[model samples]
Target: MQQSLSRGSSPLALLMRGVSRLNLYLAGFSAFVLLAATAAVFCEILSRLFFGKSLVWVVELSGYSLLYMTFLGAPYLLEKNRHVAIDIVTEHLPPRLQMPLAFLVALFGAAICLYAAWYGLAVTLDQFQYGSRETTVLAPRSYLLTWVFPLGMVLLSIQFVAQAVACLKR
Candidate 1:
C-alpha cells in the first residue's frame, strides 16, 4: 500500500485500497466459480450415467464460468507473483537494473490492459444496443458476459499500475 497513505485519510487512496481488497474477494469468487463448475460437471455426468438424463445448461454455464474465473483470478495471480513469465534476460540482470525493467514491463502491461478494456467496453455496449443473445443452450444476453471482460481488464490494469508504482519505489 505504498500508494496509499499511512492513515488512509485521502479519498482516492482509500478508494484504491478498498478496490485492492475487493480484487482479492473477486479472486475468491472466481475460485468458487471453478468449484461450482466442477460440481456441475460431476452432476451432469452422474445424471447422464445413472438417470439417463442431461442438464442442458451445464456445459454452457461451465464455459461461461471458465471465462469469469480466468479474468477474475488474473490480478490475484499477478499480485502474488504467480503469473506466468519468461524472464530469460531479467533473471540475468543485477537487482538494481531489475526493478526498472519490472517497472517498464508493468507499465506496458497496464497500457495493454487499458487498451483492451476500452475496446471490451465498446463491444459490450454494442452488444447491449443490439440486444444480442448467445445462440447456445441458455441464450443469455451477450452483454451480461461481455461486461465481465471490460470490468476484469480494468481491475487488472489498476493492479498493474500498482505493481509499477511498487517497482518504482524499490
Candidate 2:
C-alpha cells in the first residue's frame, strides 16, 4: 500500500500537499491561457483573411500567453515527473544507490530553480519599480510578464524540494 503523507500532521508533509495542489491549479490556469492563445491566433488568421488586416495586439498577446503557459505549467510538470530525463545511466546503478542519486539530482535542480527565482524576482522588481514597459504598440508593463518567471521558478523549486524529501524518505 502507498504511504499516506496526508494522514500525518507533519509540517513538511502538509507543505508538500499544499504545493501539489497549487501546482495543479497553476497547470489548469496554464491550459486556459493556452486555449486563449489558440483562439487569439485563430481570430488573427480569420481577420487577416477576411479584412486583409490583423489585430495589432493579437501577436503580442499570443506570445505573452505562450510564455505564461510555459511558466505556469512548469511546476506541475516537475511535480508529476513529466519533465524530460535521461535516466539510462542512473538506472544501471545499484538499487541502494538509486534514492541517494535521485536525492542529489533533486537537490541540484532545486538549487538551480532557486537561483533562477531569485534572479527573476530581482529583474521583475527592477522593471516594476522603474515603470518599464514593452516597446510594442500594446506597451504592456514589463513586470506583468516578468513576474511569472519568478513565480514559476519558485514553484518549481518547491516541487524539487518535495521530491528531494521523498527521495530521502525512500
Query: What TM-score should be assigned to candidate 2?
Result: 0.92
- Which residue pairs show collisions in model 1? none
Per-candidate Cα RMSD to the true structure, in Å, reads 2.0, 2.2
The residue pairs that clash in candidate 2, if any, are none
lDDT against the true structure, per candidate, is: 0.86, 0.86
Which number leads on TM-score?
A: 2
Q: What is the lDDT of residue 90 in candidate 2?
A: 92
- C-alpha TM-score for every candidate: 0.90, 0.92
C-alpha positional error of residue 170 in candidate 2 after TM-score superposition, expressed in Å:
1.0
lDDT of 2 by residue, 74-117 (tens): 99888777888899999999999988999999889989999999
lDDT by residue (tens digit), candidate 1, 98-160? 999989988999999999999999999999999999999899999998898998899888878
